[model samples]
Target chain A: MKFSINQKDLYNALNIVRRAVAKNQTLPILTGIFLKLKNNKLTLKSTDLELGIKYDLTVKAESDGAIVLPATQFLNIIRELPNEDVYLELNQDKWQLQIKCINSLFKINGYDPDEFPNLPQVEESAKFELPANKFKEMIKKVRISTSKDETQPALTGALFEVESEKVKMVSTNTYRLSFIEAPLKTSVNEKIAVIIPGTTLQELNNLLEDEGSVEVEVDSNYARFTFAGIEVISRLIEGKFPNYELVIPDESNSNFSADLSQLHGAVKRASLIAKLDANIITLEAANGLMEINSAEGSSGYAHEEVKIDLEGPDQKINIDAGYFIDVLKVLDSEEINIEMIGPLNPLVVNSQKDGDKFIYLIMPVRSQS
Target chain B: MKFSINQKDLYNALNIVRRAVAKNQTLPILTGIFLKLKNNKLTLKSTDLELGIKYDLTVKAESDGAIVLPATQFLNIIRELPNEDVYLELNQDKWQLQIKCINSLFKINGYDPDEFPNLPQVEESAKFELPANKFKEMIKKVRISTSKDETQPALTGALFEVESEKVKMVSTNTYRLSFIEAPLKTSVNEKIAVIIPGTTLQELNNLLEDEGSVEVEVDSNYARFTFAGIEVISRLIEGKFPNYELVIPDESNSNFSADLSQLHGAVKRASLIAKLDANIITLEAANGLMEINSAEGSSGYAHEEVKIDLEGPDQKINIDAGYFIDVLKVLDSEEINIEMIGPLNPLVVNSQKDGDKFIYLIMPVRSQS
Candidate 1:
């Protein structure tokens, strides 16, 4: 490959594709980034078998060819180079790529481009488009509830369901769950559902921008997301996702709303001692106040009180403090509505703003007493 | 102890003494911060036996008492609390500290203050004061050459010599050396010298600010540094320091000066490939050009050329790229003067500014050829 590209443009392009580069993979080529030059366009691709990313940029190309270079080393070199024109030439026989930028020159050993695996394809089973910002917001909330345990494959991903008018994403790790929905910008003729791995959702959430919309194509085996001239293909999990709707509470015996920032601060302070034990803290909501107390052990005890506007019976629940903190961090509203059926049911934290359909559920830990 | 302290002020005071708190120390009390409430001032002290830090702040004291609490846990708790009045009361029987801030309350377990070690004292010693920014700058440059190998105790510290007219700090790891000198504002009748430990230099560097001055006291056993509201006491390294004056080159056959930023950028880019091997790079300087090339290996090769102003014969030498990069990062001048006698002699990188007396020496690596 022969190309002269701006250091910043190349660095930006490399950054997008390098996210999919395999780390500690057995196949040597999987650790390399595939680069191809044609006329005036350069294409970069990387794949770790489960996920892949591809990006293209226009460059000053003297010849059209292909080469695969070590992803990390090349990225490091380009990142350190000055923001000027960078010239690259490939030696097909020895597989050495010579890179020159201003007064700095480097010759890096590369591999044959043919050895790198091609990106997996997604059949056109269903296609829909959603606002990039809203999709990213939905993913951020759903990610906190995805299970890290590998034994239950379905729980490791979020259930993405698309109807003709709306889109919903739900994830549950048995103890906590997240459900977020948004209006679909582009309508689909048929209903579709897919389970995208948590890691893929994280990467997509990081890459999506607020200004543009992303086109999503899903099939039985793969899902492709296209946004901002970048393409991401992720393998879908093959298992039955649990029915999360049944777990959500239909009514509550106790309900209240409180300032989001105040409650967040209270829980974090209580967690200083709570985290020392099982990360569990009890929340007691009465007429006009909510008290949070951490279980005392060898460390010590922590108690916090937050004023709230309650409209139902008094309630007390013990749940993981970290789970409550995670949902609070993703919330943007000034106030949050909390509801509980009793001490036995889950504590539900619902966003109070209109048109914001984000609900978080944290299961109460069983008390021996 | 019973006191009401501002959360911000308490957090700030905790930060200073926490630096001296021992990590994984044998004595449990050494890992705790000693707190004392006497009159209206609260004293906080922490020591790891080798180094100690003390800070004092005023608070509303209802009673007078003292105790020791785990440094990290207390710092973390105070950091998370809101900027409000924090009430602290001690349970003298069980040695438990009850902390209340706004609506948050915490009970922390503490140890008896009698078990904590006292801060070391410097006897009748030599004392001097210098601009905090200037002292911090000298420490930053000298600390890079301090040896990481603990076998040679003296080499793991910087020889601080205070003369009637000038103050100099020198450190050498045998392979490279850094010597920094500054004009003494206050003349002394007697000369004093001591070796300050590397960890002490690091902490002092972090604590010193640009606006004020620091009072330094040095004796046979300890060195005390007092600045702002913080005081640091460090044990002096016990051994003879190497004579670094012999390592500096007296004269050079080739002397040249180059743009500091240009050389810095070139060397950093070249080191990207040189570090893949043994971090060795060859510098060829003659006429008005200086060329830098990495020692080629299986990874690849790198070459960089920078413009310079030369006044003597051509010179070529091989040296560690990391050592060269270290001095470049510390230099604040726009131009750097480089001098070399021959291939076998050390390469000298001295500051060009007339008022600044900083010299760095990097010994040449004899080529196998």
Candidate 2:
């Protein structure tokens, strides 16, 4: 195979596929990226058995052939080469691949391309497209709460529930839960819930462009994202996700509103002292004032009072300050409303202004009396 | 004890001393900073047995006392608090430190100040000062080559050689060596060579400010640096340091000069194909052209040529590209001259311009063939 392409264009295309290539896979061929040059186009594909990515780029091709080269080494070489046209050629035996730029030449050994796994086919299924930025924003707001523990495999992924008019994304680790809703263009009479691994969602979110839109297709067992000449396929976790809607409290006896930044600052200060023991901080509300405190022997105690507009009786709740800070940071709101039913109940947090559909619920820790 | 101080000023003082506080020390008191409030000044001191740092800041003192608080926690608290005047008070047998700022109150437990280690005495020994920026630059250039292996404790420190007219610093790990010299003002006719630990030099370098002079005092067994209202004392490594002067090549038969950036770029590109089997890269110089090459079976081989001005016969040498890159990055000159004595001998590298006193020596690796 022989081809010439812009250095940057090839770098970008390889970067997306390189994410799926594992560093030390049991199979030696899995460490290489399968490259095929056909009809003036070059295709790069890589997979780790569980996740796969394929990207295609146009190049000036003088011959057509295929080769598999070390993904990481080739990528690094291409990135460091001076910006110029890169020429790639495959020998007759296809056992050696040569890449040249300016006055530099890199000759790399290639594995048989026939050993590479076949790319999965995406059949006609429930397909829809959404603005990339909007999808990324929704994922960022909810993915942090996904369970990191493997014991509860179902909770380790985000639950995507699709309906006729809206699509809901929910993630929880049984301690704190995040739910976000966005308008959908697809109409379906039946509800579909699939547990998508949090890691896959995060990688996909990073691959999406900030300004453009991405097309997503989902089947019973897999989901595919197509954008920027690349396609990402992730397997769905086979399990039942817990119903999150029932866990979100609808009414609260105690409610208050405060500037998001102000509350975040207070929590951060209190967390310094609270970090000794799971970062548990106490929040007490009384007479329109909220006080945050953490006490650890010899390290000292931290207490910060923030004035808020309250609508109910006085109450105090002890919760993990780090969790609250995470939700507030991702909410990206000027002001937030915090609703509490009781001291031992889950606290519902959401933005006070209109137009945002993000809600976060954190279960309070019972204080040791 | 009671006092009030600007949060920013207090944080800065604490940060300077925090470096001496070890994270996981056998003695618990070593993890705390001794806070001494007396005579309208707050003194923060931390010690890790081998080194100690103390910093003082002026504050509004209503009473006088001392306590030891957790270093990291206190620093974190002060960092998160809004920039304002922070009021501090000691309560309950001086075991709790209450910090109040704006509407926030933080109380951290404190240990008895008597348990903290004693500060090292500042002896009336040789004393001199130098420009902070210049001193920092000298340390930055030589410290990277300091030995990280603990087998030879003396080699793990930089040798500070002081004379009446010049101050020289040298560091080596048997593979690579760096030497830097600068003029100094001193009246002591005696010469002193002390091995100051690399960790201490790094910390001192970080705390130094630009455009000012730092007062330095050295005794028989310790070195003290006072700058920016902070005093740092470090125990010198006790042992006989190797005669590094003998290891540096004094004469060369072949010499070559090239642009520092250009050579660096070529070496880095060639290193892509070289892996951790000593990462050996070969440099061949013939007829005013230098070629760099690296080969690994099945992985790849990289070759790049750069034109240079050679002053001697053709020569070929194999060296660890990573080590060469490290020494090249420290040179302040745009053009570097490399002098080769033989194919399998130490090479001397220095700036092409006259009056540059810095030199780096790298030993070539013997080829297995």
* Proportion of the native interface contacts kept in model 2: 0.91
- Model 1 over residues B1-369: C-alpha lDDT tens digits? 899989999998898888889988689889999999999889999998889999989999999999999888899999999999999999989888999988989999889999888898899988888888888999999999999999999999999988887888999999999999988664566888899999999999888889798898888999999999889999999989987787897888988999999999999988988888899999999769999999777878889999999978999999999999999999988999999899899999888354658989999999822
Query: Chain A TM-score of each model, in the order shown?
Result: 0.98, 0.93
Q: What is the C-alpha lDDT of each candidate?
A: 0.90, 0.84
What fnat does each of the candidate structures reach? 0.84, 0.91
Best by lDDT: 1
What are the runs in model 1 whose C-alpha is more than 4 Å off? A352-356, B185-187, B352-354
* Predicted model 2 interface RMSD: 2.1
Task: Provide the lowest-lDDT 10-residue window in model 1 chain B.
Answer: B350-359
TM-score, chain A only, candidate 1, equals 0.98
